[model samples]
Target: MILDTMKRRRSVRRYTGEAIPGDVTEEILKAGLLAPSSRNLKPCYFYVVNDRQLLAQLAAAKKAGGAFLKDASMAIVVCADETKADTWTEDCSIALTYMDLAAAERGIGSCWVQIHLRKDADGNDAEANVRRILHLGDTMRIAGILSLGMTDAYPAPHEESETDRIIRL
Candidate 1:
């Protein structure tokens, strides 16, 4: 059953624009928080963005192929404080994976959005944009984002990985 849920989890790029229920959102976040972290530091933090206007702005800033954020009901910006956990990126990634699987299990669709938090070549602070958009404090750093909504298209089945990719010592 769990494997089925994992297999069904896909990077949904299109959404139906129907807002996810608040209770379901809470459960997804709880699942993310329950993920294991290095030394149990659990330093990941989440910023839930449900504002349509804000989502649009984020979509515009995204350089990736997917435009789902523009029409999705919400986006969860996962962050971490490096001082609390040096392996914050890895921890946040695991949490996001858990959230994705949990969303699929509940019939919700989600896609991961990678973000760069450092200053750009023009000296523009990337973190400043995220902080202003999410009303986050200076201590927090953006790790990644997750666009959430109802699916408008079903994902194709994944192909099997090659056995040669795995090696036993």
Candidate 2:
């Protein structure tokens, strides 16, 4: 059933601009919070943003992507506390993935925008800019951003891939 949900998920860019109910949003955040982390150090912290101005700033945080974030009903800004875990990136990534799959299961659309090690159009660090806008401390590093809303478009599910990458022992 999880694979079926994964199969049906798409990187939905377009959104219907409908607000996800507070309860549903909480459920999605819970999914992220429930993710397993290295050494049981749950390093992930999510900032559920729904402000229009902040969304626009995030949309432009990265030069090549995130344009759809402005229309997203809410964007979950996923960050990690490095001091909490040496493997913060890997830990936070799993949490973000769980949130994405959970959104799809509820018929909500979502997209993940990579921010770490990226730059904005003006050449400043993307992660730093987002931190400034959100007032996050230097100790907190971003894993990614997840835009969530009602679906405006549903891209087709991916076709089965050729079995060339698997290496069985």
Candidate 3:
């Protein structure tokens, strides 16, 4: 079942403008919280945003990407506190994957918007702009943003051949 969900999951960039239910959003967040982390150091924090204005700003935050976020019913900004773990990036990455899978399982379409190391239109850092908008202090480092909404279309299934990178003993 987990494999099935993973196979069906894809980056969904378009939505039908259907509003996601509160309980469903809560479940997705819960899944992120339950993700395994390095040395049990759970440093992930999700900041859920539904404000249209904020979403629009987020869409523009990256000049070349995230324009789709303006149409997302909700966007979850995954961040981590550096003080909480040395492997904060790894921890938040796991949480993001878990949340994506959870959303796919629920039939909600989602896409990831990468923020780290990206730049905005004015040559400002993407993470800094997002932090400013969210009122997050310097301690919090953003991992990515997950844009969510009802499925306008299901993406094509994954082909199995990409296992080329796997190494097993």
Best lDDT among the predictions, by candidate number = 3
lDDT of each: 0.81, 0.91, 0.91
| Alpha carbon lDDT at 15, candidate 1 | 79
All candidates: TM-score: 0.87, 0.96, 0.94
lDDT of each residue in 25-54, candidate 2, tens digit only: 998999999999998988889998999999
The sequence of per-residue lDDT tens digits that candidate 1 reaches over residues 38-155 is 9999999988888889988777554454356888889888888878998988999999889988888888888888765544335666566677777877777776788899886869
The Cα error of candidate 1 at residue 165, in Å, is 1.6
lDDT string for model 3 (1-169, tens) is 9999998999898899989989999999999999999988788899999999999989888767799999999999999999999898888888999999999999999988998889998989999989999999999999889999998697998888978789887
Tell me which of candidates 1 and 2 scores higher on lDDT. 2
- Give stretches of model 2 more than 4 Å off: none
What value does the lDDT take at residue 140 in candidate 1? 78
Which TM-score value belongs to model 3?
0.94
For every model shown, the clashing-pair count is: 0, 0, 0
Worst 10-residue lDDT window, candidate 3: 57-66
The TM-score of predicted model 1 comes to 0.87
Clashing pairs in 2: none
- By summed lDDT, the worst window of 10 consecutive residues in model 2 runs over 160-169
